[model samples]
Target: MEAVYIDKHYGLVAECKQGSKKACYELYRLYSKAMLNVAYRIVGNIEEAEDVLQESFVDAFAKLKDFRQETTFGLWLKQIVVNRAINLLRKRRLDLTELEDGHLENIVDKEEDDQEEIQYQVAQVKQAIQLLPEGYRIVLSLYLLEGYDHEEIGQILKINENTSRTQFLRAKRKLMEILRQKGNVA
Candidate 1:
């Protein structure tokens, strides 16, 4: 539909949909690096991330006709890539445990005015994220980085919404601990 052309990638995407492999490759060239980064953030391994990216593109192209373009092509493709990456972790048996009542109680909720942004550099923060375990890292990536709320993250991860909130809080605590250990956070 002409309305689908609102996204700039739709031009090449349309050509690809019409069986133009060159256009398809061009679109891949445009999106692969960013897509790979998304996969890497979720999977926490370069090789696995690359494999997942390739698989997601294949799946996306195969199901290309079903893409309604309600959102941009990139957003749609990102969902596929993220799902594939999370599936890989599921195969690894990601364990998202519920927090004890005391832990949640001890975790005082801080208002924005009461919170101070950490002083860590971006690279330091990224390193800390990568060092987190699979469950925590995935929750953190989906919630904080990808802009999904706790309910959406719970739906994606097949966990309770409360579990997502607990994992997010734990992930933040772990990330801050890592930064403190690295002497990156004051």
Candidate 2:
């Protein structure tokens, strides 16, 4: 049996389809902050993330008629936000590609073993994440914070699944390294 998703805000979405300005504003108010954070995680700049948020809302509203209820409105809007943020990053010529497979062969990720031993403050982890390269940060944010699997991340970023896994591992390794260097880990 398929799981049925009952969105509490379905009525508002319906109203939005009918050009109800109040419903539109309500939806925006409900989702904008989370969506902005999503964009910022991928784009790595608050100003650029704001631009992406605004543009995503505009696109979502304009394309509201085409938004079938295959998923919740929030999920749909999130997709738009993520896509727009990624496109903005592309425009800035951010290097997201992984190095050739040969170079990654010897880099074994021991993150799983190390995670149990590390104890760090939330603030330190957040700061360390920010210090990561754009590619690593984006992959890490999407996989860990945004809750996407490597397969989905690969599809979203148009890269190989192995590449996504590699990036995620490298991100975790780098994050731990940063925390250790700062003496934030216990």
Candidate 3:
């Protein structure tokens, strides 16, 4: 069944590449809801999510030629939506900070390996992340929830990799502070 879905997905991409409007519409119908949820997660508003969804499809269609199929079409389209949402957030003058290379290395090294502890931390952290400033919140969402690497985040935000890491660290710190204030931790 999953194989059938994969075949259909690839066929749609091929047809859309061939400029089939029906295929494009089918792709839109298939992915729009999931894409909208992704946009909403980043932008945190229904209206903005709708707008981003439309804009992302437009951008994806426009640049369909560049898509190499190294990953699934859904993943490619999701990246476009995330990039557009981040760009929109930046244009609004959100205060996102960049991290240095050393800092990013430190963070990667410091990440916990224990699954149980990590899950507990992640749950607590997510609650605090919700309280972050808009810039930090969006960055955190893109990096953590959406599984984008710092380099991808940097490209989306027009910053360097270091900046993405720094913002992530700042977001984490701010989240921890918020959690502490709420008495979720010591």
Candidate 4:
């Protein structure tokens, strides 16, 4: 199944490299919605996400000739999208700080029983994530929603790997607190 997907995009990408508009549109049709969702998750706004989606595709298409399938086309495209989303945030004066070994862990409970929790609706979970401070929200979105490991997230966000881990743990606990406030904790 993975091979089939790779094969399909490979052909479209080849055509796109050769300046095929139809092929580019076909590729965009296949991935645009997912791209929009990724952008929205990062930016947390509809208009900015859509703008990022357009810019990402434009940039990706321009650089199509350099794409060697070391990774899947989708993964390559997602990297571009994520970088662009971060850039957009930067344009809005989002300042990413390095934790000075701030001992954030002291506030995070480690007890096993504290992990027990009730199920949250998808909307509620999303709402809670949106309510997070930008740093925590972006780290959580990249690590959990986008499946980036701490090292990868650190590279992407230009922070220490340990900082990414700390941010993720803090985001998890903060999310739980939000859910608890909403009476969703068991």
Tell me the spans in candidate 1 whose CA falls farther than 4 Å from its real position: 1-5, 93-120
For model 1, the local distance difference test gives: 0.81
Worst 10 residues of 3 by lDDT: 98-107
Question: Tens-digit lDDT track for model 1 on 62-109?
Answer: 999898888898999998998999999888764333222221111223
The lDDT per prediction is 0.81, 0.82, 0.76, 0.82
Model 1, TM vs. native: 0.78
RMSD (Å) of each candidate, 1 decimal: 9.7, 9.6, 10.2, 9.9
Per-residue lDDT over 117-147 for candidate 3, one digit per residue giving the tens place of the 0 to 100 score: 6565655555466567876787788888788
Tens-digit lDDT track for model 2 on 102-137?
A: 211122334677544442255457668878898888
Each prediction's TM-score versus the true structure = 0.78, 0.81, 0.69, 0.81
Instruction: In candidate 3, list every pair of residues with a backbone clash.
Output: 98-163, 99-162, 99-163, 99-166
**Candidate 4: C-alpha RMSD after superposition:** 9.9
Q: Which pairs of residues collide in candidate 4?
A: none
lDDT of 4 by residue, 120-166 (tens): 25556777787788889999999988999999999999999999999
How many pairs collide in each candidate, listed in order? 0, 0, 4, 0
Per-residue lDDT for 14 in model 2?
A: 91
Off by over 4 Å in 3: 1-8, 94-128
